[model samples]
Target: MLLNNKEHLNVSEYVDLNLELRNLDLEEKKKLIWPVSKSVDALMNFWNSEPVRSRQGYNDKSECSQLCLGQLCPALYTIMSDGLKPHLGSTFGPIANSVWQVVEASSQQGPLTKTLNDLVQKINGEDFITEGMLKFHAFVFGLLNLRALDAWFAYLCTRESILRKHYNDSSVLTRGRPDEPRPPLPRYPLIE
Candidate 1:
């Protein structure tokens, strides 16, 4: 768990070492440039991962926080990454890489990189790199490549609608709403 500002500053040397190594790993990852498709694929994987999908709260629209990339709320990345940490490590490399990949792939430098650059400075911060800072980077990265993120969200919404419709249709018999004949399940679009 991450500490608040005061507690983090007083953390032990061992904890500080681990945090340093994690930050270094993230720094090294930022150096690589990935294709937009590769980054999208990685982002989709992170989105579909059990940890992320479970927190989606998809049943109710009001519960939709991290459902789409457009919802770039500050905690979105943290919620997604915290869930992935057990699988992706403390660095949250897969998600971070998605952002870095987009940033590198961009033809023009995006303003969002400023936050990322700031975080680079904070690697040596007295309080050191906090989880919130990492998530902010993720947010900025998502912001930078919103076009790709939007495409994914569009696809996600379409897919969800199809799936929900299919479920409702299938449940017609069980729900005792058999006013109409049952329709076959719709084929999902093949994700490239």
Candidate 2:
């Protein structure tokens, strides 16, 4: 949760981090190869762990597991340390180490990121962590799988079309005449 704190990381720190990533060694980049594979394995495990059966019978797809913030923090910590940290070296060491500490604290003391007031309002505080874990799993899965990218691109295209249509309609409504025809849509290279 401390990792989520705005005060701990300023704009300059982010800029420095991005610079470090770009300057990272090729050898360090090679180290990241295994983590990418490991992430897929982790995602498969999470997918398998999801309950599939309903009261009546099995379903084609199951809803994602509940958030387990406790489990999620450690899982993310593992992903960062085992998957990303080895490749980052001294560049992201401080941030990685800080995240490790947060993982440890969250595991032992419950959700460290939530405010005291937020925790007090919960009847079963552990459930909150559970929800966080589910969201974390989904996020990680999305990152590891390019399907999310495809979905995002689809969304962008749909939004662009909607906006373009709106703009054309508005222009006609305001001018009392159809505006000059829109330019031909730009063609983008197709990904095989």
Candidate 3:
């Protein structure tokens, strides 16, 4: 689990990283300069390995949180990832991507820009990066697909921590989608 602020100063690191992202506005961010689509395809491919039944929540389960965090959430994510069947993929893609976008924008819980407005000065923080992932990993990624969204929420909560740690914060949200080619919501997490 990622240590709390006690582990190190979080502000400074966030400042550095914010600079990198802020340099690029929403339109730029949408470009996917890093070629995110291919990586997304790979992740979807992995989820496609299982059948919808297997990819769906366990028959013997209740409580959305438990069902979601447990097996149900993962199942739907996988099933949705399976190539868009005309009756399935095509119908769901737009809805799914839009829902994700809403979650991405709303999850912030606040204005992130204001929070990190003076990033450079915030560098007064003193902290070191530890080796390992944060505790919210499964809860976050498993709950939502690891997209710019993953980065958005993480950045919102622990801007400094994410910047200090190595690895792409693809979890953050970005703008400019391809006509919102995601599936409808009832299929993803809300249903199961």
Candidate 4:
């Protein structure tokens, strides 16, 4: 099913599917084996496609220019045309999309599964929106208890979501002067 730029799911229907998925054992979940085969098929294509380079209507200020995906429509997305969405981009997208397709394909799944899959992939693989990139998807899974994160984290547990450790420039503040010591500031706010 085609998903609108903005879409939603029925929580009631999804709850049942969640139970079905819950019934699956570790081995089954590892293989991404869900009752919904069609959903898996569609998700394969969704993860590979890139973000909308140009919106259907011709407008530079359209979603094409916004940094984020349409989630923050009027907020103006700073993401590059080729850049990935934060949080769920490169890594999380494919993983998240896999789960989305499963949930959506179920009898209890929602119609917006396709849209959710695409958006999740965009957030993970393309932009690398994990906490490292200061994206919301990172916290979405961490802070919130959305059922969506299940498949993503499941994938993480099975295949092993690998994080390459690379030492780069320090984000810590550097002393401008080599010899001069930095002045100490009060840790607490001063009373008026």
Model 4 scores a TM of: 0.18
Estimate the lDDT of model 2. Answer: 0.37
Clashes of each: 0, 6, 20, 20
Flag clash pairs in model 1. Answer: none
lDDT of 2 by residue, 74-154 (tens): 444343333222222345453333332322233233353243223223422446434433434444344334344234323
Question: What's model 1's TM-score?
Answer: 0.19
Descending-lDDT candidate ranking: 1, 2, 3, 4
Q: How would you encode candidate 3's per-residue C-alpha lDDT over 104-169 as one tens digit per residue?
A: 333334464432222211321314312112112233443344334345444534433322221122
Per-candidate Cα RMSD to the true structure, in Å, reads 24.6, 20.2, 23.2, 24.1
On lDDT, the candidate that comes out on top is 1
Error of 4 at 162 (Å): 4.2
Residues 80-172 of candidate 1: C-alpha lDDT, one tens digit per residue: 222121222135443333322222333123464454445334433536435544544544544444544444323323343322322333221
Off by more than 4 A, model 2: 1-24, 38-135, 142-146, 149-192
Q: After superposition, how far is residue 173 of candidate 1 from its true place, in Å?
A: 30
Worst 10 residues of 2 by lDDT: 168-177
